[model samples]
Target chain A: MTSNLRFVFYPGCLVLQRMPQYELATKRLLAALGIGLQDMPQASCCGAPVVESFSDEWVYLAAYNLALAERLGLDVLTVCGSCTNSLKRARLALRDPEVREDVNRRLAALGLSVEGRAEVKHLLQVLMEHRAALKESVTAPLRLKVALTYPCQVFRPGDVAAFDDPLQPQSMHELVALTGAEIVETGVEHECCGSTLYTSNQPLALSAGRRKLEASRGADVLVDSCGNCHWLLERMQRAIWAGEPHKRLPVLFMPQLLGLALGLAPDELGVNSRVVALLGRDAHD
Target chain B: MIENCTHCGLCREVCPAEKLGGRTITSLLSGGDEYSAWLCCCCQLCQEVCPEGVDIHQVMMCERRREPAPDPHRRSFENVLRYGYAFPITEDINAMRSAHGLDPVELISAEQVRLLLHCL
Candidate 1:
């Protein structure tokens, strides 16, 4: 409710390992906007696709982190969509008294409990809520066109995510609008990036991601916050178009693009390390 | 649960993994080879379009639980078991973080991860 709420920053496993740039850019951007973030004393996977698939125990794993945040008296701000989904799913599942009791029994071993006090939110949800504040901090406007993948976990199962209208998402568009960037209308804008299937079937995942990329051929950049989606659409996209003459649109996290508009250098936002070079005013305008 | 299905096949229409599997949700749910479940990407597209409001993703998740952990996914889980993250915390990663003017990341202690995994 306040302009400057502090949250337990849950940089899910993927962002820390595969995409630290998102964390750096997000932290810097949040700091610039005067939002406070506290690191979790113990940050672990939210028990998503892998653990969630294997056992119901995944809920306990997710609730454990929520309990940690509750103990710290802070809500969680997850940078990864899957982590947000897993944590939210666990929170929702905990609403059933029987399930919460069972999970709490398991957490008892770890000296934790499913108190259900901590709320899990995707970064986009947080930013969208504070777009007005964020807009005031934008020193420069990004003139480039941007297309974004809402990432299934963050948008779908809309009843749980409750961040935006999944069928007609506007949160990302609203957030991007604050930076003065054009949100291009891509046909496959809402398609699943097939990121969860990357490990199961690489070709299928790549093909699904290619469809979205091909659809975004007209946009200057593709943006998404989900690490899995970013990995497929941005990193695997290169291999998907190997040895072919194709448009190379850099896939950026929302913060990276917003960071640029906030007047942070490309290096500070880790844009220089991106697979596709982003051409802004000084770079190629 | 099959009673909830309307046989409209709208879920199949939106599902990428079902397309890859060359099967429909009805077939998979109606005693088809469980291997078809492995093809599911867990994107939840099918769940979104199901007119009957049936969670086809839950069906696929049930199958995934039975299957042996896929190698890559297993490796990622093991990474968390060891380092509280799905990726190794190497010096290069630390340098990259420092280069970005970020503090060194402090992951959940490996001890805690192991204990949690064991308890769960």
Candidate 2:
């Protein structure tokens, strides 16, 4: 593992406010993999999809966070798919001279400017980049069957993310495999989890989540990388599953599973006993 | 970019919103109602599969700016304006972070955020 691999961690608003376990698990896993994480000072939202809808000035907010990362002189690493997409889009948009100039002028008011120096990488990209270190770090191979819920924004709009196949994503499958877990093909891995849609239409969003959960019934546990996906698929499972608690599948963030494989305690990675019990055996066994 | 839509309906075929019986890129391209723009989950699949490089996400965003934003989106924008985050962060967040053994985040003040985003 390259001990010098460091990133300014950008735990987007969703994770910061709603998903502490995801944050804890990600930080724990990255540290064990020899990756250093530095918190961005005075960082705020990347003005996620919500801001993009009402104003072109969303670029300003995204650039604002990027400029903050630039101040630290390190690439930004994010755990949320929406933040990854919003920040990457803003970086691309900043390449336009006029947009860059305007954004700089606005940022200058806060003593910040974005030169497009910092790159934004999602957690999946970071894990895939350190596959060798990850494979070596796995002390307890998770033998459970796992189904993946791919974060839509993390891989799609191909040109921007540009890391994996947008339609048929294999990076996650390959990364999860390094943990010695069998990857189950649920057929709905690429579908939207509908977290964004929940804002406008609750029933439709839950239905989308329900579809994925139903499709993954064959698997022992469902794994997701994005906070939005976890929120709908895991937190809202009761509402989506509706009175069939036994039918509900255990959901774990990508790093939680990886942390377990790395010989970290389930409690340290914020893995609840339910998820541990679903492992069907001691994590080390 | 919307003009480049060949109306191949490939975006419609891949759109989860459309599959779930909501109007989406194909409907918006055909002059569908304003609500069509709000129905997207921001999955970017429609943009990914567009044969003509139509940037359907941008097209939907343009349409969204024209309509009244949904309550959740409106509240999110307000939260950004008020707290520099899409969700409110109170002092207790630091307590939560401490429990998780993570460092407390130093949030930018709303005054600074307001000055930076005054253009909005």
Per-prediction DockQ comes to 0.60, 0.83
Q: Which parts of model 2 have CA positions greater than 4 angstroms off? A: A1-5, A280-285, B30-35
True contacts kept of 1: 0.65
Which pairs in model 2 have colliding backbones?
Answer: none
What is the DockQ of the complex in model 2? 0.83
Q: Which digits, one per residue and each the tens of the lDDT, describe model 1 over residues B47-110?
A: 7777778877677667677777778888877776677666776446667777767787665766
On a 0 to 100 scale, what is the lDDT of residue B84 in model 1?
63
How far does residue A163 in candidate 1 sit from its true spot (Å)? 1.5
* Best model per lDDT: 2
The lDDT of model 2 is 0.86
**Every candidate's lDDT:** 0.76, 0.86
